[model samples]
Target: MRLLLLFFTVVLGADESFITPQEYAAQLYHNPRGIGCHLCHGEHGEGKVIAHYIDKGEKKAFEGPPIRALDFRRFDAALNRRNTGMPKYFLTAPERKALYRYLHPETVKDAHAEK
Candidate 1:
C-alpha cells in the first residue's frame, strides 16, 4: 500500500502547475541563453523587423510570420502550424506543459478571449 501510494504521489506530482501570463512572458524574455521570444519575434511581439534581403528585384524584410511569435493568446492557432521553421524543441512532457503554461497563461483571466 505504501509503495502504491508513493507511486501515485510521484505520478500526480508530475502534473503541471498553473502560472500567470506575466511570469510566462518573463520566462520567454529571459531564457538562459538570453535568446527569448523577442530574439526572433520582436520586443513587443509585434512581428516587425528590418529588411534583410532582396528577392525577385524586391526588397524583402525580416518580418516574423503572420501568426506571430507563438502568440499564447492563440494557442489553437499556434499549434496548427505543420511546418514552421521553429525548432522541433524535443521537449519532454513537463517541458511542453511549461511551454503551454507560458503561452496560454492564466493571467488574462479570460479563457474565452479571442486570438
Candidate 2:
C-alpha cells in the first residue's frame, strides 16, 4: 500500500511540475475535490446567479459573489473558514493559492518570481 501511494505521488508530481501555473490553477478552479468552483462562481470567478426563486411573493436570486476582485487574504479566508451557503472545502494552502491565481492571472508572475 505504501509503495502504491508513493508511486502515484511521484507520477502525479512529475505531471504537476510540467504544467504551467495557469493550467494547474485552471484545473483546481474547475474541479477541486468533487465540486467545480465554476458551478457556483462564474467561468472566470466573476460571480453568477445560481438560481432564481420566490420568497414571500418576492423574487430572489441565489448568487455566488465575485471572487476575482478579492485580495488573497480575504479569498483564502473565505475558502478556509466555514460560512453559510458555501460548502466546507477544507483546501490546503497551496490549493487556495492556486484558486486565487486562477481568478487573478496578473499575480501569476509574482507567484513565479517568489519561487
Candidate 3:
C-alpha cells in the first residue's frame, strides 16, 4: 500500500512540474538561428527580418517588420499597446510566464547598460 501511494504521488508530482520563466527565455535564446526565436526576431534579440516577400502584382517587395522578441524589461509597456504586430503565441499560460521571466532579466540588464 505504501509503495502504491508513493508511485501515485510521484506521478502526480511530475504532472505539476513546470519550467521557470527564465528557463523558457533561455530556451528561446539558445534555439537555433533559423528555427527558433531567431526565425522571426534577430539573433541578438535586436529585431530584424529573417524573411521577405514580393507582392504578386506590385513591382516592389513588401518587407516585413523585424521580429520583436519580447523585450522583457519593457513588458508592461509593450503589453499595454494594442498593435505591436507580434502574433499571439500558442503557448500555455505557464509556458508564457516562463518565457516572460527568462527574457525579462536579460532585457533589464540590456536596457540599463550604456549603449
Candidate number with greatest lDDT: 2
* C-alpha positional error of residue 20 in candidate 1 after TM-score superposition, expressed in Å: 8.1
Worst 10 residues of 3 by lDDT: 106-115
Top candidate on TM-score is 2
lDDT values of the candidates? 0.50, 0.85, 0.50
Q: What would the TM-scores of all predictions be?
A: 0.43, 0.80, 0.39
Q: Which residue runs does candidate 1 get wrong by more than 4 Å?
A: 1-21, 32-35, 66-82, 91-115
Q: Model 3 TM-score?
A: 0.39
Task: Give residue 10's error in model 3 in angstroms.
Answer: 17
Could you give candidate 1's per-residue lDDT for residues 35-58 as a string of tens digits? Answer: 455555555545546458989999
Better of 1 and 2 by lDDT: 2
Tens-digit lDDT track for model 2 on 1-115? 9999999999999987877777878998888985798988889998989999999999999998888998888998898788777788978898898888888888666545443
C-alpha-based local distance difference test score of model 1: 0.50
RMSD after CA superposition, every candidate: 9.1, 4.8, 8.3
Local accuracy of candidate 3 as per-residue lDDT tens digits, 1-115: 9999999999888754554444446675555222465445555455665445567765553233442454544543443354444544445445444445554464444432321
Sort order, TM-score high to low: 2, 1, 3
